[model samples]
Target: MSSALEVGDIFRRHGPAYVHAHDGHLGRVERRVMSAIELCRTAALGGHIEGCQACGTVRVAYNSCRNRHCPKCQGAAARDWLEARAGDLLPVPYFHVVFTLPAEIASIAFQNKTIVYAILFRTAAETLRLVAADPKHLGAGIGLIAVLHSWGQTLSYHPHLHCIVPGGGPSSDGTRWIACRPNFFLPFRVLSRLFRRLFLQALRTAFEAGQLQFFGDIAERADPQAFARLLTSAGRQDWVVYAKPPFGGPEQVLAYLSRYTHRVAIANSRLVSIADGKVTFRWRDYRHGRRPRAMTLEVGEFIRRFLLHTVPDGFHRIRHYGFLANGQRAARLAACRVMLAAQVPKAEGRAEPMAKVAPTPRPCPCCGRPMVTIAIWYHGQAPPGGPFWNDST
Candidate 1:
């Protein structure tokens, strides 16, 4: 057994049996996720050789899978994403808002992930922008960075969107910036009501368009009447839209985004041990004051829960909307700065909070110097014979 336990370890050990057993249920995305995690950073994918610049040490470095769902690859991905987003930050308070799907809706969402998740993003962003633009509210065009999280602390399928929104934005005419009160952004009740209405309406549209599919227990939802009943039930309930306190500044916002943007279902550090066909891992019970606790699950169950969060290929989990929309983000942000009367930012100082954005390379074990890539190899090619280096830090 490896000294450090990883989700990949469980997958590599029992993935074959799990895959065979669940062959009827698993989709291509989940199967690919399992295979990628199992083979990540292994010579099976092929990598390159690296040598120390200071010392004459040589080592074999394997390639990373680079799959978004792979736990080992998110750290570097987060760093790169943060570096790009750093310049887009505005000089204002930022709020963290979460929009969650109710359990009833979440059940439907699980079956129609791509459509429902897209609805979640769209409705959540629309809710924020609509509410902010109301004259009764901030009455400004707001920008937000929305990230989709499909798992809870216990790796359960709990879908939610975490949105980092600037406290204010340019007015309708772009003449001046409209800033919200220092402590308040928008009314939660108004946002919740609108979000619920928008999502159920969108779900109905998708259903009518023959875009939603159902199977197994939910197969009956394929019936128009049955689906309408589900939506009606979901509509009656109050949706949850929570806004956290304002961030201190752009630095804190960058720090916060760095953590949530590229997160996977679970990190390898949470694993305690795997034995007796059971996997032990740490989690926080949020209901109980976030007290630390450990839960043990059968290895197969663990793998299933982890794989449940694999998103569809080519689907973006992180998105920008309103003023931050990728197409007009640069121009809109420039206008916002000018309206706010903030100093023009220099290239070097744009993302000072992310000064450490570059990931530190794994140092040579023998001399503690950064290893330099000496040679590269393609997949299915034989690598130079040497000790396989553990590139993880």
Candidate 2:
């Protein structure tokens, strides 16, 4: 078998194939991302070098690719995000909820990404909040962080939102923290039905405003009747709303949140091989027993699969609503901690100390010792001033 491919290597070898195959409007986004990834952290964006005092190693640390879709760039971001969110974790149990749209809607999303995605986030959150607020159910106004992922394990247009919701919410009067029963939360059937209705209604509004486009097999959605029929069919079909078992406590909740937030369509570790110039990787086929298997594709096809997931410009995939809304999170979290602490003997869950966030080192390929950052330029932003073309020094 040939060696496995890191993201950089795949970009170098097969990126052109992706760019060439994608020759239309959507293709432009893919091309831009590819260029950004290739030059990110390089002299192209302008960066400086650093030397390790101990090892006598000199390396050039370029600026990060920074494209949210880039695999190499999201790690440090995920960590920093979790840090600011540290105090938000309460001692209460938390649940992981996922709501997925069918392929029928996914086609519309492909054309109207930012609009449909925003609607998806809105409808999904509303469904959860509405269901949980009912006295017959959880009967509380919950806090949840929702992240939208637009691709399936195989890089298909399978838009879904992943949510980490606290098991309880504050009382309607905001006087005390209300907690859900230990073993149960909202009713999934109710959540699915409501989510389906809200999404279709929002989609219809988007269509009437002429905000949606149609081409290929899905082009007919531009027709009002066709759009209504599509929604009606989807209404009959099950809109999947799955909730994982309750976590042990808030610590487990943050650990879970750290996974979904800031993640792209796929991960580097999942790539297994680039043998004979063919890219091979693993994916979970959720339809058939959720079985795990490997897929091998020629370099061109491989990149096409990867490029299919490049999101629309300025789209915010991670969202917060209800009490977890950004403007109100701090006060709400503080209240949650205080309320939980009063009820449970140990309400302030012991959060794991955050690991240090350090600048990435570019080590010598000759010897894997860490390279140092001798100087920073933005003065604080990133490497500045592209390197000299010819410098032996």
Candidate 3:
């Protein structure tokens, strides 16, 4: 199902004004995202004409912008990504863990995104590995897949890492599989304390090394005393480290991954309306039992919030750690299966065939005959044969 409301529609209507309003403030990446969303699946990009053989029906399918942040483009990308991960699943329960930064740190992260976000991933993964390997804990080497999300439901900057981990792992000596209690993964209090310490230490080191930048409200933190105060206050607060119950099985794990792995700040379906120059959209108020509510903001504000999540160019948001780390993923996974005495599961969903081979065209809606590409149109170019039927009709 598709929504009558789309992010592109919002962009098409108010984007230019928003751009003009923000002018010098918008970064290069934010401008690129806005441009991509506005032009996606439109004639601004090139497209082809598909004509039905039997009914002589023709339709113009515009090309996608393929921007990672675009809602329409993520569906295909998510499916493709999930298909690739299907083969990596093991016959073991998986746990969902989340590590979030406190508001102070989040403020700092907003200024130093690339460095701080990278540190968050590394420290979170390290905390998990360190805790899990202790004799008092699971005492094994675990595999993890972590994805970063930088926005809350209302598009606020809320940087966090979501980790999917198997319930058990190979022992320290590579001798046997060690599993956690059926109902428990790790003690959240322990995880929280260690994560807080490691993260703050890393932040202090970065600050001292002059690798982190302070801006706007946090600009005063450029002073060592002010920065120390910020760190001390954050260390006193309880960091959030949550661990959800283990998934029922591998299929459930895949289902959860499909939703989160490619999610943007907001999906188009959540958009309710645009009227009187104010855009209204649905958001979840988590503090209030997660009740659904509508929020209306001016066009510029909406675009501003959306741009808060445009990550630095070429920075990776999803990463693997420990046994799932890229260098030894295949070898470690094989060893894991051997420890569990389990057979390698056949690949579940096949990847799309190589793009070098053109796919069979879809049948026409009217005549049920295969449609052929009758013509190709580049950006700003009209159809070769002219309008087949009035699209507005």
Winning model by lDDT: 1
Tell me which of candidates 2 and 3 scores higher on TM-score.
3
Q: What TM-score should be assigned to candidate 2?
A: 0.86
Give the TM-score ranking, best first: 3, 1, 2
Q: Each model's C-alpha lDDT?
A: 0.88, 0.77, 0.88
Per-residue C-alpha lDDT of model 1 across residues 1-393, encoded as one tens digit per residue: 344998888998999999999999999999999999999998889998887767678888789999999989999899889888888888788999999999978888888898999999999999899999998998999999999999999999999999999889988888999998988999999999999999899989999999998988789989999988998888899898998888977888988988899999999989999999999899999899999999999999999899889898888999999999999888998898888776847442334434654567779999898988878888788776654444552
In the range 176-205, model 3's lDDT, one tens digit per residue, is 999988978888899999999999999999
Per-model TM-score on C-alpha atoms: 0.92, 0.86, 0.93
Give residue 152's lDDT in candidate 2 (0 to 100): 78
Report how far residue 66 has shifted in candidate 1, in Å.
Answer: 0.2
Best by TM-score: 3
Question: Model 1: residues >4 Å from true position, as ranges?
Answer: 1-3, 52-56, 344-364, 368-374, 386-393
- For each predicted model, how many residue pairs clash, with residues at least 3 apart or on different chains? 0, 3, 0
